[model samples]
Target: MPVSPRIGLVGSQGAYGRWLRRFFEQRMGLQVWGRDPVGDTALSERALLEEVDVLVFCAPIRQTPEVIRHYADIAAGIERGQLWLDITSIKAAPVAAMLSSQAEVVGLHPMSAAPKSATLRGRAMVVCEARLDAWRPWLEAFLAASEADCVRAEAEQHDRVMALVQGMVHASHMVQGAVLRELAPDVGGLDAIRPFASVGYELDMAVMRRMLASNPAIYQDIQFDNPHVAPMLERMSAQLDKLCDLVWRGDNVARDQLREQLLERSRDYAGKQSVAEGSYAFERLGYLLADLREPRFISVFLPLDRPGSLRALLSVFEQRGINLDSIHSSRSADGELLFRIGVSRDGDATALQDAVRAIEAEGIGRVLEASGIA
Candidate 1:
């Protein structure tokens, strides 16, 4: 009879720890033990450390260094066949520690939010292969049980992508939060404005809500741990300055040139294929640049009084199966609102028209210019 894998989860009382524990126990049918690093567990860390074949360091990113050092030290004394793993978002530090530990370690980063009920359909597990030949079977089997697809990538590569993915996303949320908070105190008249709900608005709002709900410490860890933040922020600032110059100074030529440059950049980065009329930039499946052929500029106009009106318009698109490739909003100098959506060629243009009509008829929003992807 085959032996079930012995699983040890460090910092089990914490959310991610608990999430992994319950998931493995219920799905993988493994004998699992959890050790709270805070010393809150009934079992001693050492005692629990002794019994597992695989140890997952699931502590928060901030706690990762100490946890990694301690675990590396502990694993040095353990048996040779044990595999050490970490499920933290930031990969470099823990991957280094695990590599130095000589415990046949592999780094894993789960891309999904902690499974709402721990059911892992359509989730992705990124494995930084230290020794895939040795650990692949077990890792594949374990993740398979939870219905997660495995994506193999290098540790540094994973961190690089994450710096853009998680870092940029959370930063956007933070910026939105700041904007919202700045507007909150004077929002007395906001309620009087019509509700402008749209799929894009809901998407942004969802990001905002999730960021608001996340721990500040975690956000700080993400900001500081991502070494890519500085250069990226600088580039973003430069682009903003260019846009400001165009908008405020009436630099049409510069604006047009900048717009073309942006389109060229999008093609270089996202691909040259026209974005389908209704699909989001995210769902644009292909070479990033080759697949994104839409003219790089778009503008949306809405009534100035209701910012939420944008959200309602996006919701209408959702109902009609339209996708927005790139989107941004701003209030015009004359008290009119504008929304810009970059769409794909295959995206449903008729749906966008219907949504626009609905928004206008319901007094939910005003469309200043709705340009279709060429």
Candidate 2:
């Protein structure tokens, strides 16, 4: 009979820890040992080297970096071949730490969670092969048994992609929540009702809900620890500023040319590579409208300074059968205003802004910004 691998899990009570414990016992048919003395089970971490064939670090993202190195330091002192693995969201730092630990290491990340007895069907798990020859077969078997699809990625690639997939998405929803809180409309108002909620609003709220339910520490670690996020965020901010200038100056021709230029650049970028295993194109244009959720709408900004401008904007939008989600506004240092209006997909944002410019009535606001709304 084949001997079962003696597995030691450092964390036993947390959500992921419990999920993994059951996964190995029920699915992989492994002789899973809990922390206990005199039963070939490790009662403490110090005794891990005696019985464990594989040590699984199933700690939260924030705790993994510190705990991985701590255990790795201990493992490094031992003079035997032991397999170590960490299943954490952020991969790069832990991979580096494990390399420093001098133990046979592998990086694992389960793409989705079984918050409550969720099966692994159609889910993805990223596997970083630090020691492929020794551990690959067993890892593949484990994943296959669990009904998970295994995808191989480098440590840096995982981190960079996650910075956008998880980090930026979370950040965008956070900004949405902040905007809603600042506005503070009645919870029972029309805005809260089903029919009144546009796709963009619903999608934004859904993202916010997911973010709110997650561990704050994980969000903080993902946002601050990743090194690649800053440059991406800066580029996005600069793009927004450029869009703002185009709207403010009423340069419709320039704006159209710039939009085409941006789209062309996106096409060029997307042509170079594949994402999620060639399943999806990798480009800014395709992903840009993802945040909007309803890509058919064009949003216009109306300065709050114009007393009746909001009503007028809505009237024009309504006449044209445009879907207006919400108006985003902020105050400037010189008492000027910045406004972001969300409208239906068919309505041309540039055309709407041009119409507003033609109105040119006294105290009517200029279009400060406009963009496609998903």
Candidate 3:
């Protein structure tokens, strides 16, 4: 009978570390050991090195390189069949440190947020193999059991991609949050401005809030620790300056030309075959205009003096299979009631048309406007 591999995890108290520890013990049914930086665990450094067949470092991104270097002597002493891995967002530096180990080393990055469930189905895991000749089969088997898509890439390539994917993206959210705080220092200011915000602005604010609420150290590590982030930020700043210059000049023709150029570039980045095949400037504007003309939602304005009017308006939408995404009712100074109903583009067009015609025919309320695109 074959002996089961003993797995050891460092930084077991962090979010990703806890998730990984649970995954290995419960899902893989393996005997696991853990070492937490702040407290004592079942395994000390010496015990981990001596007993475990596989060791995983799950420390913060900035701490990973140093942690690997600190354990170099112990890792070098591990047997040839033992495996070593580090789960870090930026891979190049830590992968280099892990290469010093005599054990088969591989750098792994889980592309999604922390694991919340037992299975990792439909998630992506990036693998940068350093010296995995002896451990590749074991890594593959574990990933297969977890049902994750294992994508192989070089360490430098992974860090380059993460510079944009994590570093720049998080930086944008942090900037937005900072701008909002500067403009609205009062606690209830954001709430007071919600009614005037557009759907797109609301969505952006929600994402910004989520990002700001997460662990600040994570974002700090991503922006400051990634070697490629500074250059990417410089490029973004240059582009922003160009856009600001074009807007400040107020040259409509020049702005339109710039917009077309941006659209072409965006299509290319999105993997369109050719500029002619999917040119947003030439092909998409017409479709976009047509879509705007299609009714996405109906707004009904009724006099406050009239009763049962709100009920009648809702019945029309209910009978038409129109699901309301949002509904806001506000009263004007003159006692007129403004009711806005948001509907998705996926709803029935004929039903919406008939409902609108019926509402207009009955004169229950005047249709103020229709919003969104089909």
lDDT on C-alpha atoms for all candidate structures:
0.71, 0.66, 0.77
Least accurate 10 contiguous residues by lDDT in model 3: 285-294
Tell me the RMSD of model 2 versus the true structure: 17.9
Off by over 4 Å in 2: 34-42, 76-79, 115-118, 184-194, 254-258, 261-374
Q: Give candidate 1's TM-score.
A: 0.70
TM-score of 2: 0.64
Which tens-of-lDDT digit does each residue in 1-374 have in candidate 3? 11568887878788877888888888888887889877746677877778788889999989999888878766566546788888888899999988877778899888776755565777888989888775667787888887888899999999999999888888888888887888876646787777676545665787788777778888899899988999999988887787777778878876795787665577767775665664555445444333334456677787544678788888888887788666666544343567767676687777777877888787777887765532
Give me the runs in candidate 1 sitting further than 4 Å from their true place.
38-40, 184-194, 267-269, 272-274, 277-374
Worst 10 residues of 1 by lDDT: 284-293
Tens-digit lDDT string for candidate 1 (1-374): 12577888887877788788887888777788888846557767677777788888888887886787886776566736777889888787788877777667788888865755455667788888775456668877776776768888888898888878888788778887787667855755334321554446556776788777867787788878767766776776787787777778766787787778766676666654555433556444322433233563346676545557667767876787876676655456453447766665577656666766787888866667656633
- True-structure lDDT of candidate 1: 0.71
* Full ranking by lDDT: 3, 1, 2
Candidate 2 has an lDDT of 0.66
**Candidate 3: where is the Cα deviation over 4 Å?**
1-3, 185-188, 271-374
lDDT for position 231 in model 1: 70
What local lDDT score does residue 374 receive in model 1, on the 0 to 100 scale? 32
Candidate 2 positional error at 53, Å? 1.2
